[model samples]
Target: MSPVRMYTTQVCPYCLRAKALLKQRGVAAIEEIRVDQDPKQRDAMIALTGRRTVPQIFIGETHVGGCDDLVALDQRGGLAPLLAG
Candidate 1:
């Protein structure tokens, strides 16, 4: 499986939901960057994704966008192949 990373806040429901979906998809670990606590990480996340939003997700080198984007990818039958990469 490719590496999974998520930029999240402590109390983000979308972040939690995103994690649940990832878990269901057999993701054993997620490198969570808590941007709520660290301003630097938040800046990095924005710079990398071009969006300042909680739950910015990266499946390996692919920027998977936010929670809804992930669900859409799964619905389109693309997430599994991306994860497998």
Candidate 2:
């Protein structure tokens, strides 16, 4: 599977849901960047994604976006293939 990375906070429901979904999709390890613990990381996340939100996800180098976007990708049958890479 492609490497999974996520920008997340400690108590965000969307982050939790996103993690759960990724785990269900066979993602064994996630490089979780906790924005809640560092202001610089939060700024970096905003700059990288152009959005201030938890659960900003990436599959490999591809920005897969947030929870809803991830779900939509999975629903569209794109998630599996992307993860396989």
Local accuracy of candidate 1 as per-residue lDDT tens digits, 1-85: 9999999999999999999999999999999999999999999998998999899999999999999999999999999999999
Candidate 1's C-alpha runs over 4 A off are none
Off by over 4 Å in 2: none
**Candidate 2, number of clashes:** 0
Q: Evaluate model 2: give its lDDT.
A: 0.95
Each prediction's RMSD to truth: 0.5, 0.5
- Evaluated with lDDT, which candidate comes out highest? 1
- Count of backbone clashes for each model? 0, 0
User: Using Cα atoms with residue i matched to residue i, what is each candidate's TM-score against the true structure?
Assistant: 0.98, 0.98
lDDT of 2 by residue, 1-85 (tens): 8999999999999999999999999999999999989999999999999999889999999999999999999999999999999
